[model samples]
Target: MTLEDWGWSPFFAKQFRTWQSRGLIPARVIRGEKNYFRVWSENGELTVRFAGKIRHRADGRADLPVVGDWVAIESQPGRRGLIHALLERKSSFARNLPGRRKGKGRERIEQQVIAANVDLILIVCGLDRDYNLRRIERYLTLVSGSGAEALVVLNKADLCADPQYYQHEVEGIAGKSVVQLCMAKDPEQLDFLFDYLQPGKTLALLGSSGVGKSTILNGLLGEQRQKIGAVSDAVGKGRHTTTHRELFLLPLGGILMDNPGMRELHLWGEEEDLSESFTDIEELAIGCKFSDCAHKSEPGCAVRVSVENGNLSSSRLENYHKLKDELTNLHRRR
Candidate 1:
């Protein structure tokens, strides 16, 4: 198979030129295990090991190859794959490591790498009791900060008697971009989401457990390629179905990655991304009396005025401030 057949482009070709001179082969990592990976090359799928130097040079887990990383590999005449170097990434989605004990005694807090080189982030939220606008805002902040476009997908729409109500809620947070509302089990409602499936683009689905991420992937694939687990009928929550990050090429074009649902998503110092995700709030803040207005009890604060007048939901503004504070704290800690 040629590089084009493997989704290589001029941008990747230019980066590969230097590695080519070093007698290395170029490949894209399709899936990653603990220390090993499965890469797609001209020779087909190959199980790969990281070069010792590459592994030693890594500072933490984020330095390793992820599902969508393009890498330079050392391939012999009849060998599998050997990853030599990681090419510069186009974009990445990441979050702070959770479960750390609080206090100054903590030495280091690691950043978990979710995915790399993704073009779009599909934030899936089930329309059942699992749906939360604040959670959607959190995902939006992470995606926007990652420097990738974000689209909100309200899965399990069939269960909701008033899907339009939730659709409007998501639209208030997701500006301009299409907010998809559909049942993970219905293809008819999924047709509206096909506009994002253009060739050469890579999209990643992210959400909490029982949000039907795997179900949505199965729906898009038109078959049950991914394992679907049953959600709890008592609590209306889904069990974690996908255990690893793996990329799949859609028959309709584009690539999709299914990742395990994360229970913790601490921010990673993305102040600008937070601003972008809450564009409505940012725009209103510009008209505040002071450039440095805190928007809390500040005289003539446009943000406060909007909230008081009901132009902006008080809950949304509260969430925005909460996220901004989180970003600030994370930045300082970093």
Candidate 2:
């Protein structure tokens, strides 16, 4: 098939030209397994392994080719390709390794790439009992820092008694760029999200389990490519649904990467995203008496005054400060 048929564009063509001059073939990694990958090349889908030079040059786990990565491959007649080099990533969403303690004898905070070069991140949160504004804020910070636009998708809207109330709550947090209040069971509601599915654009779905991410994928693909599990009504939670990350091309256009739900999203380094997500608080601080006011127990602090005067929720301000401290700590370590 031609490159256009596989969603290749001028951007990829230019990258491919540079690699071709260096006697390397261009391929897109379709799937990643342990120590191997399935790449889509000019010829067809070929299983591939990393070359010794590529393996030796890796800094850590982040150096490997993940789903949505464009790589340079060495091809041979009637044989699988060998990945030589990974192209520079346009964007990536990642997090620090969990259970990584701080201070002396601390384990290395490994970076796990969730997806690469994505244009949009759909932060799916179920309307049942799994919805948490704090969690959504965490995702917003991560996506904003990853250089991708974030859209909050509150799925299972049909299950809610008053969806508009919850929708307003999300709007209050997300501000602008809020996409749709969708029910994963309905196909018509899912079409609103299709506008972002233009050719060559890639999207990644991320959230906790039982948010109906797989059901949304089924609606978009018009088939059940991902397995959907039943959530327990007694507890209002789902069994760990997706166990892996996989990418699939939409029939209309664009690509979608479904990832396993993450219970914990420890911030790695996203100070800019935090500032962007909490722009109101940042703007409020500009009028403070001191430039470096802590906004807590500081004289003439506009932010603290706002919270005391009911202009801002105390809980919201608390969460913002918590995330700010996390970002500062992450920067110091880096």
lDDT of 1 by residue, 192-218 (tens): 768888677888999888888887788
Q: What residue pairs clash in candidate 1, if any at all?
A: 210-238
Best by TM-score: 1
Q: What does candidate 2's lDDT look like per residue over 1-334, in tens digits?
A: 5545445667667767877887888887878888788878787888899889887999977888888888999996665988888887778888877554556566556678888878889999988898888888788888877878889998998888998898887787785558468898987789888778976788888988888888888899999889988888898788878887777788888788888778789886667777778887888999899999878888999998998899887888898989989878777776
TM-score of 1: 0.94
RMSD of 1: 2.1
Against the true structure, what is every candidate's RMSD? Answer: 2.1, 2.3
Among these predicted structures, which one has the highest lDDT?
Answer: 1
| 10 residues in a row with least lDDT, candidate 1 | 98-107
What does candidate 2 score on TM?
Answer: 0.93
Q: What's model 2's overall lDDT?
A: 0.82
